[model samples]
Target: MGSITLTNIQKSYGAVHVLHDINLAINEGEFIVFVGPSGCGKSTLLRVIAGLEKVTGGELSINGERVNDVSAADRGLAMVFQSYALYPHMTVRQNLAFGLENAGMPKAEITQRIGEAARMLEIEQYMDRRPGQLSGGQRQRVAIGRAIVRRPTAFLLDEPLSNLDAELRVSTRAEIAALHARLRSTMIYVTHDQVEAMTLANRIVVMRAGRIEQVGTPLDLYNQPANRFVAGFIGAPHMNFIEGALESSNGTHMLRTAQGDVLHLPQSVAPGAPITVGLRPQHISLSNDQSGFAAQVQLVEALGSETVIHASAFGTKLLAIVPGQRRISTGDTIYLSYANAPLHLFDQSGLRIATVQTEDGHSPTFV
Candidate 1:
C-alpha cells in the first residue's frame, strides 16, 4: 500500500527549475533516503511527493493510483519537518490528537492511537507537557508521535534531527531506525548529512544540482560509485583524486600521474587519454621503505582508535587514515602506498570507467 512511483518528475519556480526529470520507483516497506548538498532540490522533491508542491511536469502515483492533483491533506502522507512545527499553545497530547479530532475520528480511537504512539516513541512521560517544557530530543520524539497517530500511507521526514546536538542526533537517529524496523512502513527521509543517510537507508538516492546522480544501497554507492561526484560525496573523509593519463608500455596498460608515479591499470584504454585515479583514505597505508610515493605531512589528527594524516604527494594533496597510535607529527616526511588496493578510475568527464575482470574472474588491482 506504500508504493510510490515518479516518472519524469520536474519542478520549477517560474523559470528556476528545481527538480529535473526525476524518475524513481519506491517499493512498499522500503526505507529510502534522499541525500545531497544544500539547494540540491531534495526537499523540493519530497514536497512534491507530499502534494505540497505541484510538479511542473511528469506523473506521481501512489499504490498504483495517480495522485498528481491530490491536495496535501488528502494525499495520505505525513511529513515531519526540521522545525518540529508543534503548536506552542497545546500539550503533547493535544498535538497528537489535533489531526484526528479534525478528521472527526471517534474520541476513544484518538485516545488509543495517541497512547500507542506516545509509548512507542518513549514520550509517554512528556504527554502532558508543551513543546517549550520538553528537551530538543524529547520534543522531536513528540513531533514523530504526532505523525504516527495519523497512520498515513507513507512517512516523509525532512531533516527531522537537524536541530539536535551531536549526541542527541545519534540517539534520535537510532530511535528512528528502530521505529522503521517495528512498523516496516515506507519512509522517505531527506538529509544533507551523509552519515545519517548511510546508517539508516535501505537504498540511497544521491542528487546533485537538481538531477539524480545515482541510486543504490549504501555499500553499493560506497564501493562502486557511478561517477566522481557520488564517490566523493558518499564517504566521510572522501576520496582523493590524482590527475593522470593512461599509458601503455610494452603491451601493459598503466596510469602515469602528473608527478611521474606509474600505477598498473586493470584494462587498456587509448594511450595518453586523460584520467583521474580515486583512492580512499582508509585504503592508503604508510610505507616503511622508499618503495612508494614521497609525501610531506601537513597535519596529524590522533582520533583515539585511528590516526588521520593530511599530506601532499606529487604536488597533490592526500589524506590517509591508519589504525592505532602513531608517533607521526606535522612537518614529517612519509611515504604512502596503496598497492593491491581497489582503485576507482574516472575519465576526463568525471564518469567512472568500468573495471575489467581477469581470466580468474577477479578484477585486477592497482600495484
Candidate 2:
C-alpha cells in the first residue's frame, strides 16, 4: 500500500526551475533517502511528494493512484520535520491526539493509538510533559509519536535529526532505524547529511541541482559510482582526484601527473588525452620504501585507531587514511603507494570508463 512512483517530475518557481525530469519507483516497505548538497532540490522533491509543493509537470502516484491533485492533509502521509513542529503549550499526549481529534476519530481509539505509540517510542513517561519541558531528543520523539498515531500509508521525514546534538542524533537515528525495522513501512527521508543517509537508507537517491544523479543501495553507490560526482560524494573524506594526461609507449599505457609522477594505466586511451585519476583515501598506504611518489605532509590527524593525513601530491591536495597511530607530523615527507588497489578513471567529460586488469600483470584492457 506504500508504493510510490514519480514519472518525469519537474518543479519550478516562476522563472527558476528547481527539479528536472525526475523518474523513480519506490516499493512498499522500502526506506528511501534523498540526499544532496544544499539547493539541490532534495527537500523540494520531498515536499512535492508530501503534496505541499505543486509539481510543474509530470505525474505522482501512491499505491497506483494518481495523487497530483490531493491535498497534503488528504494524502495519507505523515511528515516529521526538522523543527519538531510540536505545540509548545500542549502536552505530548495532547499533541499526539490533535490530528486524530481533528479527523473525528473516537476518543477511545485516539487514546489507544497514543498509548501504543508513546510506549513504542519509549516516551510513555513524557506523555504529560510539554514540548518546552523536554530535551531536544525527547521533543523529537514526541514529534515522531504524533506521526505514528496516524498510521499513515507512508512516512516522510525532512532532516528530522538536523536539530539535535551530535550524540543525540546518533541515538535517535538508532531508534528511528529500529522503528522502521519493526514497522517495515515505507519511509522517505531527506537529509543533507551523507552520514545519516548512509546509515539509515535501504536505497539512497543522490540529487544535484534538482536532478536525480544516482539511486542505489549504499554499497552499490560506494563500490560502483556511476560518475565522478557520485564517486566523490558517497564516501567519507571523499575521493582524491589527480589531474593527468594519458600517454602511450610500446603499446603500454601510462598516466603522467602534473607533478611528473608516472603511474601505469590498466587501460589504453588516446595519447595525451586529459584524464582524472580517482583514489580513495583509505586505499592509499604509506610506503616504507621509495617505490612510490613523495608527498609533502600538510596536516595530520591521529584519531586513535587510525590516522588521517592531508598531503600534497600530483600538483593537488591528497588525503590518505592509515591504520593505527604513526609518528607522522606536519612538514614531513612521506612516500605513498596504491599498487593493486581499485582505481576509478574519468574522461574529460567526467564520465566513468571501464578498465580491466590482465592476469599476466600487463596494462589493463579497456572494455
Top model by TM-score, which number?
A: 2
Local accuracy by lDDT, each model: 0.89, 0.89
> Where does the lowest 10-residue lDDT sum fall in candidate 1?
355-364
lDDT of 1: 0.89
- Lowest-lDDT window of 10 residues in candidate 2? 355-364
List where candidate 1 sits over 4 angstroms from the true fold.
355-367
Over 207-306, each residue of candidate 1 has an lDDT whose tens digit, in order, gives 9999999999999999899999999999989999888888877777877887787766665567789988788898888877876677899999999999
Cα TM-score of candidate 1: 0.95
Q: Find the number of clashing residue pairs for candidate 2.
A: 1
RMSD of each: 2.5, 1.9
Question: Which digits, one per residue and each the tens of the lDDT, describe model 2 over residues 212-291?
Answer: 98999998888777788888998899999887999887777888987687767864466788888788898888888875
Tell me the TM-score of each prediction against the true structure: 0.95, 0.96
